[model samples]
Target: MKLKKVVLAVSMLVAIAGGTAQAQAQPVKNIVLVHGAFVGGAGWRAVYDRLTHDGYNVTLVQEPLTSFAQDVAATRRVLDRQNGPVILVGHSYGGAIISEVGNDNKVAGLVYIAAHVPENGETEADNGKKIPNSAHPFVKSSDGYLSIAPEYYHADFAADLPAAQADFEAHAQMPTNAAVFTANIPHPAWKTRPSWYMVAKADKIISPDLERLYAKRAHSHTVEIAGASHSVYQSHPDEVARLIEQAAQHALP
Candidate 1:
């Protein structure tokens, strides 16, 4: 009778420990990715694959490029659909959207991939004014929409990318409204949240110096990738994925 009682106690303890361990284990769930201006969710295909392979649920948001409020609304829509906490990742102009939308309680953390980290009431146009105009000839604004000039796509936006790949991205690029650039972000979420930033050292569109300034202001965990263009996520998907993973880990208890 004594032996049987001891055996039952040991089994219960083992089961309790197993249950606790399972409860404590980190859950792999959704990460909603937002792309910058002149691009759509399609741009994140590489990063999406990497995240999915690492056991993350991933959703790519296709911003309307209509205005800041619209973009934030679109991101919030995705955030609402997620089952667990979301890691909100944004690039370039998309960062501005995340800065506003990521304030939601559902957001686990934020990742800026060569993205703008604007302060409250600041607009993309305001930040762009601080940097000298890009020497790359591919960008143009007309009829209230901004687009990349097809000719300079390979050399300016994706210099490190193969000519063929660059050309394809250039061709598939989406046009954004110029008004979106001027729209101010009433609330910048990064100011109140833990954030991670990736700096594209070789970025020509947005100055590297400015990237440093924004990251510093946001008090972000930052990593600098050398020889990368503005589209560093495309040029360095693995590094971007690693940064997102780190951000997610930081959000865990």
Candidate 2:
């Protein structure tokens, strides 16, 4: 009877120790993902699933795309909800939002996914002008807003994706005011914060050369993937998720 009790006690102790170790190993902070212009938070669904499945807390921001200030405000609202330090991630135009909002005290790191990494006082329009083939059909100006034309959804923005998925995304693309693209970022978070960049070599919407230039200027740790379109998070979700996971690890204390 005494031997049985001893074994039971030992088992319980071992279980307790294992539980403690697991808790310690797990990262407590959340990751905030911001999607760029023409798409809503829904675009990050695949990445959100992957991060959550791997035991990471994640939030995807639905930017208003009305103006740069509005987008940054939206991202900041999401950041305020996180309990601890956060990894701020942006895709495409979302990167510009992160650049402005990522300087918050709560932001531990920044990740740019086929996204812009602009310097202070730089606007997306300025960068786009530098690239010859950066124009998209959906990208148009109405009144004062910038929007993507529905027809160029599959061919320009996401040529590598399936027709149905591309169509769905194009239809779901968010509209950004021209003011957002024209507004220059006042303070770029990449100036002080650690950053990671992913370059989509096959990107047709944004010139691959421009992406490289931004990555180089930011001095960001970069990962290049070939054959991936601008919507890399959807077409190569696992890879994008893994990079995000790595960024989270880098951000952890």
Candidate 3:
């Protein structure tokens, strides 16, 4: 009887371990966020909280924004850690990074939030000229690094944010290599992967028209937020989170 009991206990342990492995191998409920230049992962704080509250494993990529190739490498490094399928998200210039990052096998879908959705052989700067909005005056480049003028952070960039907070973000901006914007993309992931886009209608930074054009070109499901500026992710975290959930749940089969 003792021998029989020990065998049953061993069998139970093996079953539990197998079950755990199977659970881990299931499709990932993971979401990886990539931030644009001039901002760190801190910008995703609200969105991160919302997704986490819903029981998602969330990872934020603090892309160095030093160079285009390096940014793509950084994003891929995070994707490498995911065990199952991943929903990749990008905000602002982060869209460009995702266009390349989504090519990874682990990626299920992509979400773009007021981001620069570029195509193969095209650079963000080149696309910018196609639309030719007046926001370029707000951008200042020094020593090959690009940064937005703090003066526009309130009126043009983050109109949805509180003045005090926007002020800090403006001054604490991360300067990206100007060449990164001019750097041509070799492969745009959106060409092959499913995508969703959120356009900040009131965005003076990237222009809503351009956002629409990019979304249309990529064949992305799109939502335009009225009166939202470039900081739409922070101002409307719920909407952004909902869209990401759609991609993770319904979109990623």
Candidate 4:
């Protein structure tokens, strides 16, 4: 009888230890958000709030839309500060940025939000060539920066948003360097990393067909948000946050 009690106690202890180990192996707690062209890190506020509220250590990368290398470096800088494994996420042109940096050892998974994903030796522009974005006829500055014309910005990029907010976003838009579009990735990270993607069906800034192609090529688990424009992150913050949460919950250890 004593032997039986001893064995049962030993088994319970082992079970407790196993449970602790399983809890420690739960999804990564670090999340890094990267924003795409013609936008800044400020756009991630809603998503950031949701993530942080859920106990995630979230950081937003402010990529200078100057060049691809610079943007990659910016993301790398943020990644360098993470304490443990990370779930990297990018939006719009930011997708291309994460595809380059997600190769870091610290990255456990990647999430793309209405963003671009280029293959080796391919530029974002090259990826979109087969099906052009409908938000074209961009306004170009003398310095070679590109932006959506104010008159068309709301309709093209944020139609789902309130008119006032869309107008403000249009005027406050960050123009991307034209050279950034032509820069190619030498090593696309999606080739190795597990990935997730959100497709904005009503996106005019990037053809939905192209988004699907990129997701399919990366073999990423994908979700399509109907009627969501390029600003799906802003218009549907709850859904975006939920997807990121899912990535965090399922990321490999």
Candidate 5:
């Protein structure tokens, strides 16, 4: 009887260990991407293709850029549709969007790629003033919308991209409302969620120093892509996808 009891106990321990291993191996499969101002979700095509090819359920949020609240609501709508825990990603002004919306219960982790990260009560505009950007002056339309000058867009936003592609991007501009910059995040999700950050070393639109400061403040797992421009996600899709994959792999469901 004693020998039989010992064997059963050992079998139960093995079962428990196997179950734990399987739980740990189950990676987060959903990914939600948010794009910044002056651009739309179309910019995420390359990154989306890569992650989708690798079997991730990648969804992009097409922000209205009408207001900060609308952008956050758009992201929340996308998050609501995710079937399971999601790895949220943002670029440029999109980071501010995620920082506000990532508080959703379905969010497992966050990935910021050359993005802004504002603290409680801080606006991206406030941060911009503290760490001024190198990009050429922004052009404000009569309606109070902003866009980069076509002549300087290539150099300031996509210097790493081919000239032809950058030129097309320049002309395909999506002007953002100036009012969007003045909005502040009340409770940033980065304070509680696991986060990863990629800094574009040569970014001109948003200062790399500010990127570093945000990463450091958030205690995020950070990587630097040397010589990358503000369009790092488009210019270095492989690296950006890999870091996002890392976040997905490690995030708990």
Candidate 6:
């Protein structure tokens, strides 16, 4: 009976040690994902799954595509929930939201996925105006909201995805307030935090050149995915997740 008790105690100690080690191995920082206009947090499933599988706590921010202020507030609400440091990620127009909220003390770094890394006082529309070859001019608006035309989905927005999926995404696209693009960002987080940027070479919604320009100004660690469309987040989840992991490592919790 004494021998049995000794063995059981040893087993319990081993299990406790293993659990502690596993917890320590997990990433210290959490990740908050923000989706751009015309879509919601559902679009971040692939990246979210990948990050969560890797043992990093991840939250997807479904910012109301109403106005920029509301989007920023939604992002902050998620940031406030994190226990330690956070890695804020934005895709497309979602990048703008992260830029506004990344200034929070909880955020350790910023990750832009085929997204706009706008400067303080600059509006999304301002970037659109300078990028003449961009697809912004082709966007349609009604009742103060803007959307991408279905045809552009296969041709430019999400060229990497299957045509059928693109068709569905275009049909279900989120309508964002058209005025949000022209609204100025007062505190651009990229200015203060370390940032990483990924650009889709064939992106149509925003010009590839403009992406590079934003990356350069922000001095972000930048990567370019050739032939990728604006929807590279969906087309290239692994690469996107990899970049976020790198940011988490570089950031201090």
- Candidate that would win on lDDT: 5
By TM-score rank, best first, the candidates go: 5, 4, 1, 3, 6, 2
Candidate 2 lDDT over 102-219, as tens digits, reads 8899887889999988787777778888874455544566476666666777877888889998888777777778777776777798988888889998887788898999999988
Best candidate (score: TM-score): 5
Ranking by lDDT: 5, 4, 3, 6, 1, 2
What local lDDT does model 3 show for residue 120?
74
Residues 202-230, candidate 5: write the lDDT tens digits.
99989999999999999999999999999
The candidate, 1 or 2, that scores higher on TM-score is 1
* lDDT assessment of candidate 3: 0.87
All candidates' TM-scores? 0.87, 0.86, 0.87, 0.92, 0.96, 0.86
Distance (Å) between predicted and true CA of 34, model 6?
A: 0.2
C-alpha lDDT values of all predictions: 0.84, 0.83, 0.87, 0.91, 0.93, 0.86
Please give, for residues 1-253, the per-residue lDDT of candidate 4 as tens digits: 9999999999999999999989867988999999988888998899999999999999999988988889999999999999999999999889988988998999999999999998878787777777898885788899999998888988999999999988998899899998888877887889888889999999998999999999999999899999999999999999999999888888774
Off by over 4 Å in 5: none
Error of 4 at 122 (Å): 1.7
Residue 215, candidate 6: alpha-carbon lDDT: 90
RMSD of each predicted structure: 3.5, 5.8, 5.9, 2.3, 1.4, 6.5
Q: Summarize candidate 1's per-residue lDDT along 172-249 as a digit string, tens digits.
A: 888888787777777788878888999999888788888888899999999999999988998899999999988877
Model 5, C-alpha of 197: deviation from truth (Å): 0.3
lDDT (10s digit) by residue, model 3, range 87-121: 99999889988888888888888999999998878
